[model samples]
Target: MDDKKIVRAWIAYDWANSAFATTIMAAVMPIYFISVAGGTDGSWSFTQTAAAIVVALLSPLLGAIADHSGKKVLFLRVFTVIGAAASVGLAFVGPGDMWLASIIVVIGMVGFGAGNTFYDALLNDITSPEQREKVSSLGYAMGYLGGGLLLAVNLGMILGWESLGLPDKTAASQISFVSVGIWWFVFSLPLFKKIKDPQSTNKSRIGEHLKIGVQRLGETFSRLKKYPELLKFMVAYWFFFDGINTIIVMAASYGTTIGIEETDLITALLITQFIGFPATMLFGKLADRLGSKKMLYSSLVTYLIIVLLGYFMTSSLHFYLLACLVGLVQGGSQATSRAIFSKLIPPGKTAEFNGFLSFTSRFFSFGGPLVFGLVKLISDSSRIALLAVAFFFLMGILLLTFVNLAKGEKEAVQP
Candidate 1:
């Protein structure tokens, strides 16, 4: 395929899978998990922690194996199906089914998180260094647009369930879950068809690939010392991305737990989705001019402020306001981080290194939700749990200051 077509196909995957991100992970399922599924205050948070742990354990090995087997697309397809199927399973969960709901959610999270390792690794294949920030940002922007658009449709179905002949809001939410699965799978077809898996001279059976993956994983860790700038950036990324992920996954549950109306919560997130589309694209363009690192710093600061404000949030208006702030910076922060990491890794090691990136981030990510869950459980106060995330943004900003981007780029090009 042509470069433009390849990039478009690549970007389309973001749109395809983001239905899960916006609806299942961030918006609908969370509220459903809490209100309809009889989830406790900390149950959803614990589920996120559990899912992150599984993905953290799996991503590095899967990524390394895919890199060696030259099967990034195949791995992506497998996990996409896994996640989509799990999403469909969620429709079967009803009241008093928190255990079943959490299990399906964990499965979905693992599929989504693990599959993204390959998706992110493919960034190196589809775009050049000069275009990466823009492409990454565009990918995220499209995710916001695509995820948001479906969320709007799902929102309509949920709000108008009575008119649509649905039995109740729970039934409407159940149908939304099914839609996410179907939407995720159907939209993923473009990339699956267009992006050919690379052929490798070292094609091996699964057992041999597993052995190679373990060796490669060990080698990458030892080799981290040679790429100090990359190491520094990874450390910084681990902190902030954890904060971002925790917020996205936990926000709806938190809102619901705090007694916000379901309609207001969904509507607030819808506002986020639509605003995020244009806002993410703008942040991407601005990153091209001002620098990705600078934009990252700005976004993290916004998150820190949002976390602080969240401690005092007591109304649907506050939830709406916080949702808007989240929409503005969430995609930009993550996209710039991905773009920056792409510049730091050596060639031909994209999948393996990105795997390690996912490993550390997801592994450490459990901490944010862990903290949020523990704090909420211990203090019996959701406000304090929300405030706790500010610590991560602070640490991320401080660590990021030590990363010299030019130095990292210089190290990457070395033999």
Candidate 2:
């Protein structure tokens, strides 16, 4: 495959998948889960934690299987279809159907989370190490643009529902779920058609593949000490990345809880999406000059500041300001972390290692929201809950200080 085509196809998947992140995960769904379904913020957080735990348990095994069989694309397709279908199903849910909504959300979350492992692994196939940081940032930039575009349309749909002949905002919101599913499916076609997979001769029967997958997973776990730097990086990622994920997942809900209007929350999300595009690209360039580690540290510091600001946030204006700050650092931190991890794993083991990375990340991710929910329940203050999340970023920064990036990169280059 041509390098440019491969990179474009890979990045296109981000464009496809991010609609789910923006609409379903970050924007509309949480609000719907709360207002329409009569569910509490804690309930929403627990549901997400439940889904993450399931995906965390399954990611390493599934990743190992795909690596052994060279069927990363196959797994990606399966999960994408599952997630998109579940997203479409969400449109049919009515008021007082929280149970049904939670079930569908879990299925969709599983598909989205598991599919990302294979997508991340594909970084090794699509880009040279020297290009990974830039390419990764490009993917995130495209994600922000694509996701932002669809969200812009969705927001208009909700705000202008009466003019559009819709009954109410509720109807518009429900239809937006269906639009996201269609958008995700339509945009994913290029990735399916354009990207080529690496070849493998290990095409065993399904039962044999399962057996080997389990064995390899066990072996990977046992050999963690052999890659101490990678292990340390995973630990740091668990803390900080969990904090990032928690913010993405909870920001809208937190805004709503603090008496910010839904329109304001959605508009702020739009700002984050559009601003994130250029910020992510700029981080790509900076990563090449300042080093990915330094860029990542800068992002972490910014996030810490965002968290502190969240505690003092009162009006829509504060929310908008914090949202822009989040946009500036969100893609930079995540893309740089991904590029750094890609440099630590062995070439052929990308899927398996990325799976392990997802496992640790998602497992710890469960705690952030859970803790946020617990804090909110105890204090009756979303402000305090938001402030508590800062501890994760602080611990992540501390642990990251232990990683030796030079040694990790050298180990990855070895046979």
lDDT of 1: 0.90
Candidate 2 — which pairs collide? Answer: none
Candidate 2 weakest lDDT stretch, 10 residues: 194-203
**TM-score top scorer:** 2
Query: Which pairs clash (backbone N, Cα, C closer than 3 Å) in model 1?
Result: none
Q: Score residue 30 of candidate 2 by CA lDDT.
A: 86
lDDT tens digits, residue span 253-319, model 2: 7888889998888889899999999999999999999899999999999999999998988899999
Error of 1 at 48 (Å): 2.6
Tell me the tens digit of each residue's lDDT in model 1 across 1-415.
Answer: 2399889999999998999988888777877888988997588878977887899889999888888899999999999999999999999998899999999999998989999999999999998988898999999999989999999999889889999999999999999999999999998998988899966787578999999999999999999999999999999898998899889867877887888997887788888877888888899899999999899999999999999888888899999999899989988888888999999998878989999999888777778888998998999998898898888899999999999999999999899
Q: Estimate each model's TM-score.
A: 0.92, 0.94
TM-score of model number 1:
0.92
lDDT, residue 71, model 1: 93
